[model samples]
Target chain A: MAEQDLTSSSILIAQAQTDTGNSEAQQPGNAAGTNDAVEEQVVQEANDAAQGITVVVEGSEVVAADPAVELHAETQGAYTEQEKSVFPPFDSSTFGPQLFWLALTFGVLYLLMSKIALPRIGEILEVRRDRIEGDLAEAERLRQKTDQAIEAFEAELAEARAKSHGIADETRAKIKSEMDAKRRDVEADLAKQVATAEARILKTKTDALANVDQIAAETAVAVVGKLAGKVSIKDARVAVSDVVKG
Target chain B: MAGTDPISQFKVKTLFSFGTIGADENGANGVDLVFTNSALFMVLTVGLIATYLILSTRGRGLVPSRLQLVSEMSYEFIANMVRSSAGTEGMKFFPLVFSLFSFILIANMWGMFPYFFAVTSQIIITAALALLVMAVVIIYGVWKNGFGFLKLFVPSGIPLPILFIVVPIEVLSFLSRPLSLSLRLFGNILAGHIVLKVFAGFIVSLSALGALGMFGSILPFVMAVALTGLEFLVSALQAFVFAILTCIYLNDAIHPGH
Candidate 1:
């Protein structure tokens, strides 16, 4: 219901606005018959409008000038004369007060500005300047610190890399030497075992040769006994041994 | 007839009277220390300057607020103007310069309102201000430079025969400083306001004639608006000119030479 009332009120205001607009529009059309009449009417209304503003300024002046109620006959003529003087700026009656107030207000302004606003504003500007310079100095210091930190970090990293390389090289050298020594020792042991096996084979061959000569002599003796009975076995062995030697 | 009269606006209507002192020779009643519309606007002008400047610097933020920015801008603007014109030694006069600048600037702006009184429009007011400026200049110059401040009138480089022509001119000009300063301001403000009123009155008068009059009033209305803009510029510019002149005059006090 409130929304409806608001909308209805707005519509009424809009209609009233149009109505005034139409009335203004209708004036020239209604006065179209007589040009001189229209001109006179315009002049008359313009004069009234001009008077309206004058009265407003005058009314405010009257209200402001005095709350004292006295419209005496003597003051009325003086008022007209005062109003007729036209150029109030040149009027000497106002000079004394204007000068007085100018001094007072201008004095107040100078005091307020000089003693209060100027110094405080100056201080604010000074404080801001100091703060900016300090902040910039602080930022420079922090940047330098960051640069130093980066340098130290890089230095540490390079040192750690160098140390790891040295350790790796030392370990590699030590392991290579140990492996060389073990290879030489294993080769020497294998050579010693091969020499002993070769010596034992040669001895076995010589011993077998001696046993072959005796067996030949015994075979030869057995052959002779079968041929010439048991006589001259020693002599048959001697002959077989001499033939085998040849 | 008096209402439409542009000159009527400058009338010093007393707002609050402290009673009459005595009747003058002209049979006019003399009022005792009555506060007029002129005084009201003057007080209002001072109040505005104080309120704005004080509030602007109140926060004192590292990152300045918009108000603070404007406040500081005005501060630095006057400060730089003083420094440039008067040199570093002239910084002592910063408060005086700032006050005059803000006071005039604000007063002129307040008068831009249709019904508001323009304090500077009065000859006596401007003359008083000009006298105040000259007072500061004379006092400070004499105090600082002693008898040597007379060098301001006599050029050091000019030949003796030419000095005859130049010295009197310089003296006359020096004597006329207050007059020129006061008249310059008063005339500018007084003329600008009168013109603005006349143009505005044209609009009001024309627009009262109905539709055809409304269309015709447009020309004056536009002209008035344009004049208003120019007046605003003049207001600010005159303030700057006044302050700078103050600085230049103060510079002579600091270093009284060509």
Candidate 2:
């Protein structure tokens, strides 16, 4: 679709060029008049050709003005009239132009593609690939760092737990030894107090026994004075001492 | 002229007649270097290709737009085709293969449109392109491989007696490659366009007949439409065939034996 439009436009441009050439050639006298007439005829022919109508070349002036335009019109007319087998594309006459343009265009395109377009595309592809690979490498590196961090955290946690357990054991052992020493001191103080109390009690008991012997001797002397009891004071003391001994 | 005369469409009309350039007298039977519709369309093909490649890649974004995606896909498609057919070494010729593919594809597609000249339909153009490919193959083949390139015709493992019979056939076949390659593309596109024109002519002629002709014209019109669809496929397929064949020939140039 685009090709046809471009071709027609190119044909128009070619027609305009021929028209200008004719105008330039006839520029001396009656130039404006011939130009106006030639332009009108060319426009009509172009329109007719576009409409697929056979354009009738009316005036000799238009034909005289531009022989090339007339030739183009006649050629187009003859083209439709002649059998397609005799077409110039098949004819050797047009192959030169066709091949010439083909080479020219193909050469330009090859240079453009190889030199400019393909390399740019290749660079884009290469850049995208490199970016992706770099991102993946970075992600892998970060993942490794995270793994190392986790490993370190676990190691530190284990160390802290072991340290806390040792501290607890040491505190428990120190408290247990201090309590045992305190209980031993209290027991020794109680034993010493009991020994001193026993000694004092023994002395009190002996003194009380001597006082009883004296009281018995005095009572025996009073009785002897009063009767026969006085002579027996020493005997009474000895009897009390014997009874105490027994 | 009959409306169904399909060959008429192939006629080349001179658009601008510049009598020969640089030469005073008419040389070579007055073969003036007049620009014709063929040149115009060829130029258009180049323009379109440039537009497609350049405009599509203008952004050069990492994440492609639709047009960029299409351009990239076409690039990768031809790239892979060259790689697979010709191997990694063939990638060096990717530009040639890609240009040929794009030009032919766009030309064939352009021909499908009404009033457009299919450049590939012309024998001269296809022949020129095919000859260029053959030239590259021969030049590069000989330059790169020296005499080893001749081994492409002579297989290794053939018995001595059978070698005499096989070598000439191999040479003949190798020589015919360019002809076959050019003709294959030209013939397919030419025949396809002719068929389409004939069918379209049917509708015109039938409808001109009368009421009954008008009803009959529908059949030809429908057939033309269907054929247009098929021709679209043929256009792309022929371009692919041409390009892949070029790659294969280049591969022979690179690795000649097997």
Find the candidate with the highest DockQ and give its number: 1
lDDT by residue (tens digit), candidate 2, A1-246: 334554665687677668766776767566677777877877776666644422222233333444443344333322333223344347665777788788888889888899888888888778888999999999999999999999999999999999889889888888878877877777777777777777777777767766767876666556655885356677767765676678
* TM-score of candidate 2 versus the correct structure, residues matched by position: 0.72
**Across residues B64-146, which tens digit of lDDT does each residue of candidate 1 receive?**
99999999999999999999999999999898888888888999999999899888898888888888889999998999889
Q: Once superposed on the true structure, which residue ranges of model 1 sit more than 4 Å away at CA?
A: A1-83, A165-246, B20-31, B154-173, B207-214
Model 1 C-alpha lDDT per residue in residues A185-230, reported as the tens digit of each score: 8888888877777777777777777667666667777776777677
Per-model chain B TM-scores are: 0.93, 0.95
lDDT of 2 at A155: 96
Residue runs of model 2 more than 4 Å from their true location after superposition:
A1-80, A83-89, A176-246, B22-30, B157-166
Worst 10 residues of 2 chain A by lDDT: A53-62
Task: Please give the TM-score of chain B in predicted model 2.
Answer: 0.95
List clashing residue pairs in candidate 2: A224-A229, A224-A230
lDDT of 2 by residue, B1-258 (tens): 245678767877668765564543423233456678888888898899887888888888988889888888889999999999999999999999999999999989888888888888889999999999999999999999999999998999999999999999999999999999999999999999889998999899889999999999999999999999999999999999999999999999999996
